[model samples]
Every structure is written in C-alpha cells, then in structure tokens.
Target: MESAPAQPGTAEWYLAEASKLRLTPLDDKDADPTQDPKFQERQRKIVDLATKSVALTHKNPEKKQQFEVSARYLLDARLQLAMTGDDEQVELLYENARAFVKRDPASHAAAHGAHTLVNLAYHNATQEKAPDKAATWRSEFAQLANHYLQTFPREEPRSVPLAYTAGRLCEQHGQIDDARACYTQIVQFTPDSLHGSEAERILRRLDLVGNPPPISGPTLEGET
Candidate 1:
C-alpha cells in the first residue's frame, strides 16, 4: 500500500510542500527571477512553508535536525528576497544572520552568517543610492570584516577574501590605517597568494607617499 502524505503544520509536511513547488533554481545570471510574477509567487510560498517549519521545530529538542534544515531554508529564502530588492527581507536577513552568530559563535553557521553580512555590506556600498546610507554600510562592513578576521582563524577559507575586500574598501574610503592593517594581515598569513601579492604592492605604494623615489627613472612605456 502507498504511504499517506504528511499532515499539514508538521515539519515533514512543510518540507514536502516546499519541495513540490519546483521553483526555478537561482542560477540564471542574466535574468531577474523576481521580475516574474509566477516565480515570485512560488518563492513566497516556499518562504512561508520554510518559516513555519522553522518555528515548529525551533523549541523541540527532538527536532534539532529539522530545525537546522528549516533554518537553512529560511535563511536562503530571505537572502533571495533581499537580493530582489525587498527592503523588509533585507532587514530579516540581517537579523537571521546575526541570530545565527549569537546562537553559536564558533559554528559553521556563524561563519556563513558573517559571510552573508559581508555580501549585504557590499550590496549596500555599491547598490544603495543614498550617500548617507552607503557611508553607514561601509562603516558596518569595516567593523564586520575586522570582527571576522579577529573571530575566525586565518585558516578559514573566507579570511583571505574578506581581508582583501576590507582592505580595498578601506583604501577607497580614505581609512588608510585600517587598510594597512588588513593588507598586513594578508601578507603575514598568505604571502604567496594572489591577494597577498596585491596587498604587498598596495602597501609599497602607500609607503612611498612623501618619501624619495627609490630610483629617479621616468615612467615606463604605456604606464601613464
């Protein structure tokens, strides 16, 4: 005999229903999925199901695995919505990411959360229209990048990229000291890596300011 479907309001039911929605995967780099009404509808349904699943399993000690899965779904949904320019969803994404970190500072989830914050910071810096808002996000990015470097070991895969981004952002914003610190960390930890090499070059450039030229040669050909 065939098995019966899971009942509504249960974790299994939520997951099953969300899976059946068959929403398009978020992999099309050239198209905006949010611009499609059908896609948006399906996404909203999945988000709702995932949210309910998370709430249902959150306080149940026996449902720890389900809670984690549901949380992942919810976080992913929020991220998608935020990328679609939904301001409310952006706020929720930030909240959920921070909550993950607060729950377990050393967990993989915390690292993922920090990375999510970094993405949002980049979006704000590049996409936000208002100068004041962009400035605020840049400040937050600097703080979060510094926190990630301090909180996670240098061996973390994200450490180098985050350091490089932070350093570049700092340099763009005239935070020379902060930029130097970030570049210094990269050179110290991964001197042979591409980022490290770039950081070293930038450091040399920074150091050259107000100092005599190493060699009084003219600019190289095609090196305006």
Candidate 2:
C-alpha cells in the first residue's frame, strides 16, 4: 500500500528513482516493475504529494511551473501503471492528461497526453484485448497530433517531432492522405533532417507521389 504523501523533496526523490528503474520484457519478468504491487503503492504516494503540490501552487504562475512538472510525471506514472492492467484507469488517465493539455497548451504537459494516448493505442492494438479501444486511441492520437501541428508555429523546433508523430498516427488510423500531407510537411520543413528522410521513405513505400506537383519539387527515391 502507498505510504502517506511526503513533502516535495522526498516525493521528487521517489519519483525520480522510480523513473530510473529498468523494465525488462514482460514475459521474462514476474511483473512490470512499474506495476509491481510494492512499486505501485510507492508511486501512489508520490502521486498524492504531486496532486497536493499542484493544488497548492497552481495559483502562482511561477511556482506552478515546478508542480506542473511534478503533476505530469505523476500522471504519467499512473498512466503506465494503468496500462499494465486496468482499462478503466487508463481512461481516467486519458481524461486527466487531456484536461491538463487543454489547460496549458504551450507547456510540455500537452505532450504527455499525446504520449499516453499513443502508448494506449499501441498496447490495445498489440495486446488484442480491445480492438475498439485501440481504434479510439488511434483516432484520438491523430486528432491531438494534428491539433499540435496546427497550434504551434511551423518553424518551431517541436514542430518536427509533431509532424513525425502526426504522420505515424495518421497512417495508423488509415488516413493515408493525411499521413502523406504530414510527411510532405516534414520534408518541406526540414529537407535534410532525419525525420524528413524517414518521411520520404514512408512516402515512397506508400507510393504517395502522384503525377507530381508540376513545379518539380524535391522527389524521394522511386517517386513518379
């Protein structure tokens, strides 16, 4: 069982330690380290403290920064834990992350929502427990990825990753056209970059190139 919430310092230490623990293949291990009963209880303690920190600090913008970071980490831990077994908690975590993203779009908090959704989608898709849930997560991930790309400045450094994620999510959701658009945006934004190259590869694989743009822009290998 989780211990009582500690003060910020102790809570931070515990959360940090938990993050550092290495996870092995599930079949080889007795349990996911994060979902080990002892670890879960310990993480719950940190979550309690982190929740308290957010409530106490949210009104003060400067102070809110630290606790907001804590809140994201705590919720991420819970999301990971929920994915180990409980679908209901997984939904709850999704809501919490979504609420945080809506409340603070510019902050890094929003990315956690995307990350959690992607993880859940991967879990449900590969585990074969709930195909509907998997579909929902993929749809949600695509929506969030598109939203992030639209909301952020195209030239922003984060846009590159967002574009890459959007491309993958769109592809996974069978929005092939949108995936092509995302990959094309990546190439346009950063032609020589790794993500651009990867996007080009996917475009080639998908045979997304058509009669060409007529202006004769950059062409991936094997493109018409």
lDDT of each: 0.75, 0.63
RMSD of each: 5.7, 8.1
Worst 10 contiguous positions by lDDT, candidate 2? 19-28
Q: Per-residue lDDT of 38-75 in model 2, one digit per residue for the tens?
A: 66665566566556555665556766566567667667
Give the TM-scores of the predictions, in the order they appear: 0.71, 0.60
Candidate 1: residue 118 Cα off by (Å): 1.3
Candidate 1 has a TM-score of 0.71
Residue 112 in model 2: lDDT: 58
Candidate 2's displacement at residue 74, Å, is: 2.3
Give the top-scoring candidate (lDDT). 1
The model with the greatest TM-score is: 1
